[model samples]
Target chain A: MTLLSRRHILAAIGAGVAAPSLVRAQSSETLKIGGMLPFSGPASIEGRQIVQGLQFAVAEWNEKGGVLGRKIELVLEDDESNSTKGVTAVRRLIEREKVPFIIGTYASAVAIAASKVAAEYKVPMLSGGSTGAGATDQNTAGDPWFFRSWPDSNAQGDDTAKAIVNKFKKTKVAIIHDNTNYGVTLAEQVTRVVTGVGGQIVSKDGYNAGEQDFSSMLTRLRGLKPDAVYIGGWAGDGANILRQAAEIGLKAQFVGSGSMLSDDFIKLAGSASEGFAVATMFEASTPNPIGKAFAERWRKSHDFDANTFSALGYDSTNIAIEALRRAGKPDGLEVQKMLKDGMKDFPLVQGPAGTTAAFNEKGGVIFPNFIAVIKDGKRRLDV
Target chain B: MDLFLQYVANGVVTGSTYVLVAVGLTLIFGILGVVNFAHGEFYMIGGYVGIVAITMLKLPVLAAIAVVLLAAALVGLVAEAILHKPLKSRDATNSIISSFGLAVALQNAALLVMGPQPQRLNLDVSKIPVLSSLPTDFGPVFLPQQRTLIPLTMVILIGVLYAVLKYTWTGRSLRAMAQHATVARLCGVRVQSVAVVTFMVGSALAGIAGMLMSSIFFVYPVVGNMIALKAFTVVILGGMGNVAGAAVAGLLLGITESLTSAYVANSMRDVVGFVFVILVLLFRPQGLFGKAAERS
Candidate 1:
């Protein structure tokens, strides 16, 4: 209760004034964005492409002045496509890094898990290549914080059907999938879309992941003499399908989901994969400056060519930064609201010219897609 | 009928590879009386070596393969010196725990060195022709250059192993030690050397499988667990201590799994395979070809 000296009080007041600016400077200068993707485990090959794309986006944005005049820092954690590990990783990003935005959780299951944490914090989260529809389907009321740059599974399947009916001109098609949520959903979508358009499914088969030989399925397919075969899978399973099909004497035209659009696929299937076609979220030669830029940057950085997710990653980050700019701050709630409004329209260097992310009352990116065929062991426009 | 034939074709391709891995596994276990838990790691290591040789170093596929096998042999030698020799005549629990630790270490090391991404490799030779007589409707079954080499390699490997075990003094000593350790040691057979050789053979096989698989399946760090599980299954199915049984059981298991995948829902095929294994265990614990003494 004794009276403090006037000089002591002034000194304490000066310290308080000095600390506030320091805190504000630290907070306003850096915006931390967490990235969770399968950098290892089964999907790591594709996951690496995803990570590279994300990096390219961040690099481009930082070069142009980061979100809201602050440097955007990306902190990546490997989920390995394990749902449990995904949740743990997102939790670490949220609680430890205090990231207001997250760019990934590539597999649908991992995305579902990570989005739970994102929903809890009202933070904005987006994915490049998870097409299970489960990633974006649950929010009938429209998820405020969850947005995706890639088309939904239903869209992909419909696109595949379009290719089959309009392009392939085939009356009967066979669908073989890995039976995961992505595979089965896409297969079902394609089946419905194809049959709806007067095309019949000659055969359908589902296989397990890590499956080595698809000869049995291929054998059945060969006997059906179907005009075409659609495979929906990736990694070890996807590669082996082509390998086994070649061994089993299957001559039908092969089509696959986005999962087939990997460099590893062509390598594993060898020359047998030359005539395959796939529907993917992106094509390296998207005829867009943004797509070209991302592709050029990526090739310079790694030996692998650009895949669909790489372009999506670039677009997703571009949208995130746009929202950040509109919000004028990296606050999760402010950025979430801005993103939901879909304010900016910067054409990213990915696929066909597209505006900034526009949500159709649902938290999904209404981005255009491409159907590329593997000709001569490379992905080229089917046309 | 065509579909069935196709499935059989698929099974044949996969079963052939299983035969190769299983045979190598059984040979080591038969002679050493020790389970090399790190066999799968050796395979993974071989894959990495091949990738580095071919992709980064730009070596021819065959040279890369040779380099991988050579590296694998060296790794096997190291395993023999450290794991097998040290554990010889020691407690089973100690060796099991130690070798398990070694396997885990090797897996992590692989992740560290290779950066945890799957890499691709192709066969040096062009595609093989498994059978040329099938009709055009049979489609174009790949006789992947690797598939043709598998059987030829298996024969060469078996013959070499047999020659080493049967004709050479080293081969005779290994058999003598395996059949009766005390008497073989007393009769001037080098028990320690034979055990070391067994470790070497087992590891080298795993490595060869790993390298060869890169041609058929993509290779990555997680592959160790996969190869380990399948190889272990093959060993148990054929009788853990029966070399010839392992070779046959592996092919049988591979074929059955392929057939299951084709006929059943893809996911359920794994369940069916496990179920079959359980049924087999319940009925004949010694496996299909396992003998009385070889039964584990």
Candidate 2:
């Protein structure tokens, strides 16, 4: 009866006008994080593994009451590892979904392309698996908007070089990598390190990704007879190279960049994977208690053992959430700043050694790389 | 000299696999007049079948290959019935579009069932008694005994196929149909039946190639796409409907790739192969074996 009066309606309208922040406050009940990955393409395996990590972390957070008492929702768009698709996916995540935070892009090229879009939109995009140096290079214009949870290619390459020179004692090393940005950059870094450490570089070869035949390369490498062959590529290619190398009796000790640190590689390579050493951020054998707990839970839930990929993905998600909690709100710009300046010593949910995940000025997560070997068909930390 | 010979040996090993894939594609194109973009998916399915047979069913290598061939043949027949047969009478574009759609669908379906991870077929052909007795090395070339078996297997398959096409009624019918479908039908060759046989035979060839290469390459859904593209290149270079031409072209392409990778830069392998194809096409637009009138 009272609302029927014009004066009462006017009074209610006045109250609504006075509480201008009410609409903004109500919309903050759920935090959205966009995910960009090649969920249905050649890189789909990497995408699926990365998502498991993100899903596990997000689920755990939600179970314990998500950050700031709001549920975290992941909005995933398949990039298919194409740069154009990556840009389009990021645009959708930012403009259409309006997600404040995003995590994505196992492939470095996709990460680089998508991060530019996220940067232009002033949204924070974190990559859990991309390690191409250019992914988070401050030399680039859009580096501020991108943060990575994995060590850069240089870190992995340096670790690989050190392992080759110290453990394998291979002064003459051959470098083989895919033609992608990640592969080329890692190969270059490894070459530099191999040369700088008083080691000899035998030959550097490049192969297209997804190429099954490496007989020619293996035969040529066998002729060179390098002390070791360093692979700057993914698990799939690495496994193939190892198999072919064994088939051709290349005899070189096969070493790999961080990308080769996957159960898929060991499984694919079979007996050829024996004694294959790789530099990785997460070694399941020497996982911290937190990592151990995460891996066990991941295995139980996903029915697959967590690899370095899953661990990095879970840690990246944890890092994003930590930054959000530190920001005290889901503002994208604020979260980006907090991720860059505030998360220097933040303890990651997963790390290979005792070190915590720390982002440098370039927003790359810095952690000590450890050497792992596929021994007896299982990846084990060697040192 | 040994290194050069080694490269040649590597080339032959790779060439034989290409021959199998290219011949299958050419045969399908010859009879069905459909490029069958999904031809590669058959190869991928064969790899997966080989994996399952060997790992899950614990079958011997030869037995697993047989299973793969049968599975691939069945897949090809089903695909022809469901996807190709309906559009066979329509404009050629319809068949192309339908085949393309089938390729995408089959690839995604494989991804769904097999997941994105690559699985290796466990075939220790190197350990087989007869294969192991053969020299794994040829001069300076360190070819695996298992790998040597692949070329030999391809030779046997191709010889059997040649004999079938030259001597058998079904093969003759399929070849007649490949030359001219309407004429083939008018001659009471049963074009539809020939189409089925063509698809089966072509798919079996691809399946064998997949089984042989799966160990070397590892099996994933997208694996077939690359091999299929290479096969297309072979098909074009050899003449779309020319099976023998495809075999020759496939070997040529493989050897070119290998020699380029060995003597030049490894990255130049595909480039050289494609460039050679373009050169050949420019000189012979109807393809190496296709009739000049067929160019119309």
Candidate 3:
């Protein structure tokens, strides 16, 4: 083997150093949008669906010659459904990837955590999956870069409590929520609304996520003799609760947030899910032309039918694209301003027949919530 | 009074599953002296096995249970031979770390195979003739036919285990090994074979528990995480390596959690176990049922 000279070694080192920057320069022609999602953790399944929606919207936009005359590119980072990891992922997107805007996050805690970093970097971060109200609560005057396309948990909870009180005419309500940020925030909203309407909350309790046995809790709720029970948790636990409640002969109207509006809930709860009402923003049976097209496209690609999270992901990506088009540049502050002021009566894949989506002053989405009930193993709109 | 009885019934049923898992863990620790952090993964595997046996193979409930047990035993044998046996002479921490790695690997394997969706093991009690004939509603306590199966299975399995441990030659050898491994081996106990048997039995117990609970809770990849934590708690509360203590502690912890959820805040139900464990550790380090370490 021939020994390398100092000049040859120096040339090799220089090439290695220049390689990454050269690649970056070439890729700079494409407008890069960051996606922070839980692609490999507990919420990975939901993250997969959201990514699909993001990719679908990006593909559609690219087909139409991309945004700002630049080919749109998506830079993805896995947050692992964790708060700390979410912050790290968002920082990488803003600092390393240098994307002007981001779309993501399934978990509320992750969304809330990552949005702080996005706000610090002055990058517009659009959340499509997280429903917790705390994410938008961080959009202050000093750092107003977070926007949520999906309706918050408070909206769903408010509508659910109204349905239980005014529609179902249930005075004594018991609330069982998972002890997570999303569940707790939603439960608090329901409690506030129910008590505000002269309704008595007999028993309000929280259970850990993945808890299967709700026997004692249901038995205790039975003793309270409440007219309705509001469940604020994931679909798995909610299904188990419904089944256990029926087994213990706890006869009360069961209501839940958008988390319950899934086939898993109806399938797992079986006959117990009959008449179980949930307040949701997105339904597969949405009558809107855009929603119908999205659902059809989703079904054509994926084996299963489109759900709320996917619709949220698709809508949020489209919202970001629309803002970018209106802003006429890939500037973060301009994109944020467009999202805040320009998106008035924006059409969404979610909401009612004639309902439109808009961003309120707090960066939260203003959309109509619908109450649906499980009827003969199918979720049908009740109100 | 009826409400109290109902809560108690609920506690007992929930406790039965805990006993099954914790007893297996205790037995493995007692005999092999190997802290199997992967014990919960066996339970998860059992649920998946049960689902496959029933859904894909179209087996009856009894046949599906047998399939789960056999599959779990095979997996236990492989795990013992490869993961445990090779590192047997090394530091105990080595085995523990290996088992922890095994747990992660097994969990991810299950996730890859089953996907992330939670699957229900639809064992219809109405279809079972004997179960259908039994009265479900007893005064104030309403125990569903499916739930009643849990305690019944727990009693039968524990009884079989107790009988085997008390009367059989293998049982005597196992007890001897638990008492003193070196002395037992010197007395021609065939330590290696006995260790394998102990691991298999323990894994089978955990697997069966998973199968039973899956019918009620539904089965997911990470389904065993919470139950395994509860089992470890039971193992500690009852005194590690003490089978009888595990049984008692499992039932006691279950009742305590149920009562706490009913009387106290439901949110504090899981916290009760850790708190009790801390109290036990501070007050009685030898555990409630565990005797003081005796010199041979």
lDDT of 3 by residue, A142-249 (tens): 335778875677777888898899989999999999998778888888889999998988889999988888899988888889999999887778889999898778
Error of 1 at A345 (Å): 4.4
Candidate 3 residue-wise lDDT at B140: 78
RMSD of each predicted structure: 8.9, 8.7, 6.8
Interface RMSD of each: 16.3, 16.2, 12.8
Best lDDT among the predictions, by candidate number: 3
Candidate 3 pairs with clashing backbones? none
Cα misplacement distance, residue B274 of candidate 2 (Å): 0.9
| Backbone collisions counted per model | 17, 0, 0
**lDDT of every model, 2 decimals:** 0.71, 0.79, 0.82
Which regions of candidate 3 deviate over 4 angstroms?
A: A1-31, A40-42, A69-71, A287-293, A296-304, A353-357, B127-129
Task: Evaluate model 3: give its TM-score.
Answer: 0.91
Q: Per-residue lDDT for B1-296 in model 1, tens only? A: 54555556556656666666666667667767667777778888888888888778988765676887788888888877767777867977766677687787777667656755456675545323333232334354445455555555666776677677679888788778777788998999877777767766776777777777776676776577766777778887888667677777776777787777667655565566567668768988877777655435
lDDT of 3 by residue, B247-287 (tens): 99999999999999999988899999999889989998778
What digit string (tens of lDDT, one per residue) describes model 2 on residues A75-189? 6677777888889888988888888788888888888888887888888888857877788884244247788866787877888888898878889999999887778888888
TM-score of each: 0.85, 0.89, 0.91
TM-score of chain B of 1: 0.87
Q: Which residue pairs in candidate 2 have backbone atoms (N, alpha carbon, C) closer than 3 angstroms, thus clashing? A: none
